[model samples]
Target: MTRAVAVELRGVSCEYRTRTGRVLAVEKLSMQASDREFVALLGPSGCGKSTLLKMVAGLVPATAGEVLVYGRPVVRPLESLGMVFQSPVLLRWRTVINNVLFPAEATGRRDAAMRERAMALLRLVGLTGFEDKYPHELSGGMAQRVSLARALLLEPTLLLMDEPFGALDALTREEMGIELLRIWQEQPKTILFVTHSISESVLLADRVIVMTPRPGRVAAEITIDLPRPRSGRMRVLPRFGELVSVLQDEMGIAT
Candidate 1:
């Protein structure tokens, strides 16, 4: 039996009309993310990576083409999808668990099961002990983990992440990447991650969808065959370097 397509973009195009002129951000982009697969949108600045993400999240409408989730047209945000931004965006006053509970409350899911699910998600993100800590008390990486936990609380079938760890320090970013993989392994959800880092894409994604510069289109989609449970050591592997080099060339960046 064939698996279902979790998300599909068909000839999807977006154009913005400005005072100067119409600016095309993405054009004729077609892609599908399989159920439970972790896919990454890898590209340079102005590549419209975030634009595609916004379209999926229903935050912005596509100028042309269709965006579908679970075989249905997505004209607006759906409950089955959750989103995490580059910033944690947690309320400064809310504790970690409260922040996780915020979404449930907003969606009117504040029930016993919802509370249990929120606490479970916090533990899944490895923040079991820091549930009561405020965002100010948490480090950048820790804060992002809370954000991830919050997104998971919605029990979304699809998770959309836009450069979710772009602001962390090098070491912290690397550690968070590992933690993300662990979360993915435990509870498989279809993930669409947008990232500027080639290595991060290769490390975390089952497939890397490389987009072109402005007016972004699908330049290439490469499958990452590296073994799972990937870590820093995978960075030094020969095949890993080759994949990075290929992605670099695709991005028109020097090796």
Candidate 2:
């Protein structure tokens, strides 16, 4: 069965105008994500992975080409989209459940039913018992869980995540990766994840898009045929090692 296209970028280029000069970030990059597909973009530090994600989410405009979501041009910030950044930007004063309801409240969607939905979302992200706890009371990973629940409050179809687990410790990052996969399974969406960790990308994504540094463009595309409900042991398997090795080579990194 052919999956429908959920996102499309055509000859997209992003340039920043600064006092010094024009800096080109993404140059003529094109890619597509199928409906409910989990796509991960990987590259070095200076690559435009994050910029590309913002463009697709309508937070940034491409200096050239176009970005389309569900076949429509992304001309402005998409209300149907949800975004989670590196930092879990939760309000310190708000309790866990309140923070999760922030997005819905922001757009005036709050109601008895919406509040119940928010609680359910918090539960989905494994924050069921701590809904009333303040941000200061939560751990780093717990805060991020709140952020994830807040992002999903609107039940968006396109989810854009920019290194959501980049700040956590190695063990926590791995745990979050597994939890994210579980949430994705329960509630499907078209996800575009930006990350630098080769292992994390391989572990979560159906297809990993590798890019070159600055003036970022797709350098290689690796399809992971690994089985679903992935186990932690899968990362040590020979096939997983092979895929990671291929991605490392694409980045010119010695394994």
Candidate 2 per-residue lDDT, tens place, 84-189, comes to 9999999999999889988878889889999999888887888889988999999999999999999888989999999999999999999999999999999999
Question: Against the true structure, candidate 1 has what lDDT?
Answer: 0.93
Question: Which residue pairs come into collision in candidate 2?
Answer: none
Per-residue error for 14 in candidate 1, Å, reads 0.7
- Against the reference, the lDDT scores of all candidates come to 0.93, 0.93
Candidate 1: tens digits of C-alpha lDDT, residues 1-255? 577999999999999888999989999999999999999999998899999999999888999999999898889999888899999999999999899999989978798988889889888888888988999999999999999999888788899999999999989898888988998888889999999999999989999999999999999999999998899889999999999999999998986
User: Could you tell me the lDDT of residue 8 within candidate 1?
Assistant: 98
Estimate the TM-score of every prediction.
0.96, 0.98
- Candidate 1 to truth, TM: 0.96
